[model samples]
Target: YYAEMTLVPVLNYLDIVGTVKRHLLGPRARNQVDMDFYFKGSAFYLADLYTGMSKVVFLCFWYASIIPAVYFLTAATLMVHYISYKFAILRSYRAGPKLGAELAIFGRVYIFPLAVFFLFMQADYNWSSFPFDNVCETNSTKVTDSYIGSHNLQYEYRDKDGGETNFLDNIKYPVEISEGDSYFKFCNQDMYNHSPKVFPAFPFFQDDESKWMSDDQAVFSWVFSILVIVVLTLVVNSILVRRLGASILSYFKASYKPQAITINQRFSEQSEISAYVPMKCDPSFLFPLLLCDISDIDTELIGWEDARNKYDSHNLSTDVIDEMKEDNEDAKCYCILKHFPPKKND
Candidate 1:
């Protein structure tokens, strides 16, 4: 009910969006950035962080195959994060929503490791009747006396003679069978009457029936060892993948390096800087205008008094002139260009 009512609608919506996208851009083209549109302009930092942390917790718990506490916590955290993200998406960005094909690919990739973890859990069950201290479905119920010749009923047989006999080697019954000493010497009719004609095969060594390891023996120790190894493998693989991906991206000029900086001093000075620029000239060339020192002389503001014999004069046709410096202190250094049209040639 949960999947049909909730997930079906979501999948339908995605399908509809995908159909629309295919109509716009040909089906051959993949829309990788479509899903990003929802979070593009939103304040999704907290939601995104929590969502990723929830997945990490889930993966840890799944790989460990330990207690259920972490799984429950991760589930609750994921639910809260999903709700938080949905709220933010509804109220945040104004961009048109897009559904991306990468969503399905990412979902499958994330689930692949979990599937392996589950398969290992299944294998653990088949390994032994008592794989751990806690009893599982395989070992929940012990064999009853009603079923004779079963391995679980081994204690019922008495070992009479110290001699060993191979029953499968001969058609005649061994003499130890009537003596009631040989546990393996079961009556043909009784053996056929056992609930399961064939028993599950053991994967490990099958030296003697008494030599097998019970599920209760060192179960937690083995589980912990497996968990540690799996987690270590995952961490190492993640680090290698990150480094490899960065190296690959470097070829496309997409890789970045992080740098740290310290602010040694902080000061603020209010100032105004403005300039008249021709539209044809690029703005990049005008960057020096903002860096001009405030102490530089402005040729346009110089009057006759400021220019009076304090500066050497030079006649120039252009209204713009280069700044000049004076060696003497208290002597103003400035530039004055001859006005345009030379005062109408009067």
Candidate 2:
């Protein structure tokens, strides 16, 4: 919406004006000085200025968009980890290993596709013919005459209206003459034989053919640059995510052991230790205990003594049963049948 409202209009205006100037007025306008020079110069100057300004604007847009995009992606990733730690630690803990392996495999697989997408977006695929060289010719003519007569006096030729005529038309020279006579000496003989000739040497000439031939190279360069940028961004982003995930996982692992230890200590002191001395049992073992009225246990024929014998006879600790009894002797003891220790052989 922002682009449509602000940027697109400006870009369209620039495109329209640029197309008109480049295609319509650029070729037809002659390089002649006149009262219109100021207007023409101002127009061209404004166009050049706008072209440079547009480039800066485009660059700013790219920078603005890319920086925020990268930052948002990074921030969102961190936020996800934070939320995982806060309310979803169990899932987060399990997800770390699986996500890490997937990222490693997918990062390698998608690198080339990312590069190609970038290249296609930035590349110009239009094909047109260009000129290599051009030749232009202009022609003019001059007339001269050959004469064998000797002139007594040199006189300037004039037209009937007394206008000066070119004297070279009246001049004459012998095609073949024997040398050694002063009277037949050459007088301005070399001047009549010379014709004005112009030979221009122009280097670095290119026409439509050259432009057409080079267009593909230009397009290839643009595509290649875009590909390079995309590949770099992808690889860098993948590395960053991989590192971030590892860091989060490490922090979770580092915090887990301490928390587990604290829970173990609390449970042990409250229920496992018969007295101050630690019992000969696995500190890590988990158990379930049941609570009921003493009447219910006697009615079911599963008395406290029976339950204790059922679990403790197999060498498993019945801490819950003892803890419940200590808390209330008259309170009945119910067994967590699912967690009951296996029967012992007599």
RMSD of each: 23.4, 32.2
| lDDT tens readout by residue for model 1, 1-346 | 2332344335333444434534544433445334333223422233344346435554544534444454565465556545644654454423332345554454444554554544344334333323333321232244334443423211232346755543433234322222222232212222112234322223232223333345553364356336545754674465456656667778998556566567653211112332231112122221112111223343332322223332222222112333453453222222222322223334
Minimal lDDT window, size 10, model 1: 285-294
* Model 1: residues with Cα > 4 Å off, grouped in runs: 1-54, 93-99, 109-346
Candidate 2 Cα lDDT to native: 0.35
Per-candidate Cα lDDT values, in order, are 0.38, 0.35
* Model 1 alpha-carbon miss at residue 154, Å: 46
Give each model a TM-score.
Answer: 0.24, 0.17
Runs with alpha carbons beyond 4 Å of true place in candidate 2: 1-73, 81-87, 91-103, 111-346
